[model samples]
Target: MGWVNTHTRELFDGYYSLDITYELLLGGYYPTGINANSNYVARDLAALGLILSPQPPTDPLKVVWKTIWSAKVPGKVALNAWRIAANILPTRRNLSLKGYDGDTGCVLCSHDPEDSLHLFINCPYASDIWSKAGLQWSVNGAASMHECLLATLPRLNKEEVNKTLMLRWGIWKNRNSQVWEQKSKHASETFLITLGWYEDVKRSNASPVVRCRQGVKLVKPRAGQFKMNCDGAYIPSTRRGGVGCVSRNSEGEFLAGASRPHALLTSPFHAELLALKEGLRLAMTLQYTEITFESDCALLVQAFQQEDQDLSTMCLLIYKHASGES
Candidate 1:
């Protein structure tokens, strides 16, 4: 490969592209097509073109994006802000712009057309929620969600950012309720509810993972019957996946266990299906006629129980060993 331009910072001992080149494309080093620690490089590399513009920097939208991602909020909440910043929300004004023929008034306040900017920042409902958050100062002088967030998020601490994102999400939720359920919630009420939600999430994240696992342990089934628990995991970064299965007797004794790592698997749902297939195969191979399969993934189990499960390619695999199960 020829020499490439990269900053002497952030990755690969001084180069930028080489890290992705070595981690994602170097098949010999990562046959599984993912780096260790599951930091798949595909997503970051996919956005390389966006950052490598031909001209110099000055896009405030980029700053808005950076702030949205950096905010310590739930992914969905952050995503809501991102959509608002990008002016891509499916607000009534946007729908009409896209040729939708219907009412385009603001759902909460009938003062003006409902765009992302108005719905999230300008409308009286949103303004009330912002006041409840005690950050009305940020919105008083801003024109768009992008501008408001770019200025507000960078100056605030982590907790404030979380509150802001949650409040935004709650406002959107309130709008949805008004549209779909005809239920108009108060803006201050929405703010208080979302504030409580944010605090709960923050506390949950702050607690140690070890505390959650303290009392949880696998239990074996009754003595004569057999049970198999299967699970699968997939990493989005590298499209790498793995499936594992363990069987136990009624006496609560381990009988057999097996796992397989996979590459290019589509999703955790796909992996869960593979895990079930592997479990069925394991049980049949061991000649266990009374084995009951188990998986924490409800979607996989639900698909298997569906009347016609052939909707997906992986669903077909679940049937391969079905006729042989007791």
Candidate 2:
């Protein structure tokens, strides 16, 4: 007579609820019959000894996080770079460690294990792309992904870091296309595409008005009218802000200018409103009667033009100043 597998039988028989038995048999738990909660997958992975417990970062990892996230790269590119540095990217090697059974060879070169470092830094294809892009540093001798990033970041300026991150992203994208669509790109082609992307990003970050109005002369105010131009600047890293305002005559000759730093952290909108308020106060003090206030912040200007029930702190301050209550 054949014997039933005792361990499997015990697992099924020991469960008191149908739900628990179903969860064990199907390899997932559905708290709600039709809709599974989002955390169930994470919980299931944790129970299978697949997911590692979270730990506090060491000093080096903290530095790497700060450097990657604070780079002037785009948000998605920066996030991917951070994931690569953290070794959390779903490379074939990482997926295999997480219980997936698949080929773990580098998809680009297929000669080495597809770890984050190998795919991004140590791969011959990646090295070729770097060389074609004219980057000075090579990741051939770097010990690990974090070490490579730490060493590479210090040598690159903001623009170079942005380009480097974009190149890494481009390589990953090309690898995916090759795997999924059976399409492959040459290193020179990838480099050219990444360069085009970087140029587009640079252009998008430039002032639209300035780009459109190249070589156009600025219009001056009418005679006997003084124009008060206000602007604000804020730095996210330091959480500091400053405001400046300048009064110029119709001839574009500066009459007065004032600049002051904020005592506390604030948003750019608040800083711009404060600058406009200060400019109004300065004009009144300087006895300029026919003064036109101007600022690049179109939203703040529109807020002043139309009366609404905006209860924001910045709106309240703007309302007060615009109504001559301050």
lDDT of predicted model 1 = 0.73
TM-score of each: 0.46, 0.46
Tell me the tens digit of each residue's lDDT in model 1 across 181-290. Answer: 99988876686668766765765678565534344466666668899999999999999999999988887677799999989876687788778888878987999978
Where does model 1 exceed 4 Å of error? 1-58, 138-142, 209-326
Candidate 2: which pairs clash?
A: none
Q: How much is the lDDT of residue 323 in candidate 1?
A: 52
lDDT of 2: 0.74
lDDT of each: 0.73, 0.74
Cα RMSD of predicted structure 1 = 23.8
Candidate 1 is scored at a TM of 0.46
